[model samples]
Target chain A: MDHRQEDQFEYQLKSALHRQEPPNGFTVRVLARLEPARPEPWPQPWLHLPSLRWALACALGIAVFAGGWMFQQERRRAEGEAARQQVMLALRITGAKMQLAEARVRHLSER
Target chain B: MKRTLLSVSIVVAAAICAPAQTIKVPESWDKLAAKADDVVNVSLDKKMLQFASKFMEEDENEKHLVSKLNGIYVHSLEFKNEGEFTESDVDPIRTQLQGPEWIHIVDVHNKTERENVVIYLKMVNNQSLGMAILVEEPKELTFVHLDGPISPGDLSDLSGSFGIPKNLHVSEKETSKPKAEIKK
Candidate 1:
């Protein structure tokens, strides 16, 4: 073939290889597969509500109050028990002393 | 009429004279005075040095007043307020108590009220034989001088005078009972 005809053929082959074009039915197939995504119903959104935070804080407060009240009651009970023990000890001592004194008095009377 | 009147007067005089027939006054003031001296001499202020002297003079019956219980020589106890007692007031007493026979027992503090309680006990042969004093200060102060034979077992009894009641069940019952009752 002549050089001019050969050059034209090479140019035509290069252009064909480099050219860009949309694939056949590419856009339509993607749109058909998507099916509108159904919007996902927005995920309930309760975690973001103000009432949930309020409920959590109130529960924590109530738990803390209950713990504090129980602690106070236990402390007071312990104190009362301690006081009772002290009183008991004192009384026992007094009784013993009185008995000793009585013995002495009796001994003296007999003498 | 005159004879009846004279008889009535004689009977009245005899009746009046009957009560005076057996009455007699005894001279016992000297004995009483001596006893008063004994009590005063053994008082807290003067007892320490005088104790040995007075104890020596006690009769057999009176000697038992100073009990030697559990190897302890317990003599007497005296209670007084702090205002009525000064450091100097107790100096002579304390000096005698601190003799070789006695040992320091306990000294405690009330941190909240800044008060103190001091106690001393006497020991012979490593056995508690006597008590010296118990001083408690809580705004007002109470000083107790317990001189007598004491034992470890007697400690509870000694502490009782300060309102520490023994027999918890009995005290509980007594305290729980109402002091007064009302009738509708």
Candidate 2:
């Protein structure tokens, strides 16, 4: 009984594990049964690409530097103009004082 | 590119139009004023001067003298005791201002009173461009630099509003005293 039962078990196992040719059109049938998988949207665009990331960072740096330089130049020009105007104004105020003084002297002479 | 270049050109043109000469005042004027017991520093640049003129009532007979002004910087530092600022401190300004661009119009020095008054006129092609007055006393140092075309008569017209008219109409008696004394 033990030898017969063991032989039967071995045969069943062999049969289960044995390689066999699939039926004709098996792949086609399986593929037809399978649903088409939906593609997920890209989480990150060009920034996720290692090559483009450095380019993006460099472009940003250049833009900020250029903006800062332009601003500095404009500020310098404005400051120079302001200083010049102030000088001229100082002279005018001086003129007014002198004129007032001369008028006083003239008025006295007339009296 | 064209627009940016155009804008830049406009800025350059503006810079050229008002080639502001460096108005000489002590760079330390603000600091000195801070150290004094009393300080009166009045700075009216071109824009401020223009804005101030708007408040003045329109006069058809007036020549709008204020429009001619570029700026007015007046700094008066009054100390508790004398010698808060040494003569060395002002000598640089005096020296720099002694060139042909300037003419010393009035020099009144009374050593007994320890007072000095000197007025400088900036002459360009026989026309006065501006004026600077440096007044020094034992306890006070006052400097006023007015830039632009200034006529005393034009100033007299605006005197009542500016507290300058009273100083302008000084009689012979007050004129005999130090003009600086009557100025305040």
Candidate 3:
């Protein structure tokens, strides 16, 4: 609140914020701390064999082809089954209507 | 000369590959369908019939019939109330069947009950080429068109092989409302 106290506060503030020499290897230590941790990659020695690479590729292709073929077969089967059901239903409905018509005709003939 | 030959071949191919007959439902029928509570519309082309034939293991007759069919179209609509559709709405299909190719087989109309059943057969050179059946009740309408060589005698086989369920009596069909299982 007084000039003396103000001067003392300014002096303390300057002392606390004044630049000072950093400890040895401060930059080196910070840089090392900032560096990210990385795990060693897994060994891929098989990847280097051309024949093995080709074989693996072929196996994948075969698997994909087989899966697609199986899916197509299943789709055809489902479609066939559905078509069969529709045919049967249509036939049944047609049959029922015809029967009714026949009975009516028979009744009329009797009359 | 090559172009002429190509055109001739194309025409021949079309004639050979085309179905015996086809049915066209009137556009107004679509309006009725919108008000229907349940509708059954099944259409199968030649390829589909062939595909279905493969699965008709239960019935040899079915397999034979399906293999010969070029197409089958069945449309049945059940309305929530009576008078959803009128006789005039069915006139277009009936008129179409009145052509020289189609012969009117059975026509039974009960004016009191407002029920009508009309059957037609498409004949080419005295051989039946197709069959069409139209059934109209107070609250329901059904039309079936089979495009292929199907004779009148075949009708009896159809009635017996896949006979109507015993519960689906003709008398009850007028009053009772039982949805066909396929409608589900």
Candidate 4:
């Protein structure tokens, strides 16, 4: 067929396929269909909550407190041990001097 | 006259009942320790003594005295040369100890060696309450005072680590890292 006749035929076919007036609620229906799925925001606001933050903070605080308590106990234990050693050493010397003094007294007595 | 005598007797009896005075160690002795080459200035009060008793092993002789000790004062000063300390330095301490509640237990004199050891005990009601030992050597001066109930027999038996003698050689001990060497 001729170019003019073909153009006229294509226009008539497009017009026949196109809607003259949209159906009732056609815009609303199309818009609703076009609307993306809400997907419930991935994580439910209840599932990943503020309470979880509080729980994490409490756990970290407990761990820190326990570590500090253990450190303090260890330091006190070390101090007590050092004091013990000093006392024992001092006592030993005292005993030795006592023995020497006694020996000297015996020597004098013998003389 | 009888009443006056009775009143005086009551007062004297009351004075004897009074608790013994705390031995006042001169601050000069403490200062001397600060100046010495090495000093063992341990003064454990009642609470500290109780704490120290926990570290001590279960020995009858040691426990007998260790449990009774209310205080421990040790001031030992070592010098680089002979005649570092004089009689005048220790005379004041000797004088203080000469007062009431004290008795000379033993005195050892070795003039040739320049080593003299004097031991004194504080007595109350025939029971020993405390002890003091003064060792005056040419090179060192040591003063050890243990306050509380003690027995001479028990003290003589006391030594280091059960039965180990504390006679560690001075030169070897000075080379040792941490152990205390009893310098005679």
Winning candidate number (DockQ): 3
Residue-level error in angstroms, candidate 4, position A86: 1.8
Give me the TM-scores of chain B across the candidates: 0.38, 0.70, 0.75, 0.68
Candidate 4: which pairs clash?
Answer: none
**Which ten contiguous residues of candidate 4 chain A have the minimum total lDDT?**
A38-47
Total backbone collisions, model 3 = 0
- Evaluate every candidate with DockQ and list the scores: 0.01, 0.06, 0.25, 0.12
Reproduced native contacts, each prediction: 0.03, 0.08, 0.67, 0.31
Return the DockQ of model 3. 0.25
Tens-place lDDT digits, model 4, residues B50-83? 6656666666556556667876666677766786
In the range A1-111, model 2's lDDT, one tens digit per residue, is 699999999999999999998999999888777646535556557668987888888999999999999999887666544444443333344444445445544544566
Query: Model 2's DockQ?
Result: 0.06
- Candidate closer to the true structure by DockQ (higher is better), 1 or 2: 2
lDDT of 3 by residue, A1-106 (tens): 9999999999999999999989999998888876765455555687779998899899999999999999999988876776777777778778778777776666
Candidate ranking under lDDT, highest first, comes to: 3, 4, 2, 1
The C-alpha RMSD of each candidate to the native structure, in angstroms, is 31.3, 14.3, 12.5, 18.2
TM-score of 1: 0.28
Q: A21-92, model 4: which lDDT tens digit per residue?
A: 777899989879877753456555664778986787799999999999999988766655655655665686
Q: What is candidate 3's CAPRI-style docking category based on DockQ? A: acceptable
